[model samples]
Target: MTEPPSLKKEPIGRLISYIHRTQQKRLSRSLSEYGIGGGGQYSFLKGILMTPGTTQDQLTCNLKFDKATTARSVKQLEAAGYIERTTDPEDRRSHRLYPTPKALKFQPVLQAILDEGNAKLTRDLTDEEEDQLIALLQKLNLEE
Candidate 1:
């Protein structure tokens, strides 16, 4: 048997990429039965559920997603019966997103799925280590 080649150095970027891809795959496979597309769409659903009547543009800004991606997720979730969009009374051109009853029912399950992913990722780390890691990641993200 042959082993795969390893990088010369441990790269944080590579590690982060691997974590993202792996988590996406796991969530997608596990959540398919519930009719929710895995990945960013899940976040979109949760975001809308948390802040109903938020506009797609708002979601784009709040979630740091590109406009196109946010639009697609909103459209898909609407089609899936998870959300509904209403034209903003003050701005006819803008639509506000809201979660449907189906989405409300699914919210807990979606959260549990996310919790499962976090537990899997931090299974080996102590509570202090997890807190430290989160602090460092936040600092890195906030760096300008």
Candidate 2:
């Protein structure tokens, strides 16, 4: 009897990692056009835009980032005039994050870049194929 071909174990992780790295590089290049650098800053900005007035702890949980990294990103964003922190009225000891007008102004540029990236990533895929891919990814997340 003929033997079936064996699948390589390493290719799955390696392929996924390579794809992630390439996407990050592309995103970094896009962000650089707007004077922003680093993945953390982009992530923080996205999170703040999604949940204005979010606290540091809330950001950490939402982004799955550690406290130190989130705090550093927040500090850098604040200094860059992209975000501001206000004391929570209910809890003076805690601060809430909000995007500055400067940051809001960049929303269109950021959204354009994201839309372009999404278009490129799904360029050749049919709607069904895209849906299947998304479903598979969701399944993997559920497994986690």
Candidate 1's C-alpha lDDT? 0.90
Lowest summed lDDT across 10 adjacent residues in model 1 is found at 135-144
lDDT of 1 by residue, 31-95 (tens): 78888785489989989999999999999989988899998888989999999999999999999
Question: In model 1, where do residues sit more than 4 Å from their true spots?
Answer: 1-8, 142-144
- What are the per-residue Cα lDDT tens digits for candidate 2 across 1-144? 989999867775677788778877888888886766775678888889889999999999888888999989899888888899999999999999999999999878777887887778888999999899888877765223
Q: Write down the lDDT of every candidate, Cα atoms only.
A: 0.90, 0.85
Instruction: Give TM-scores for every candidate, taking all chains together and pairing residue i with residue i.
Output: 0.90, 0.83
Off by over 4 Å in 2: 1-10, 142-144
Top candidate by lDDT: 1
- The weakest ten consecutive residues by lDDT in model 2 span 135-144
Predicted structure 1: clash tally: 0
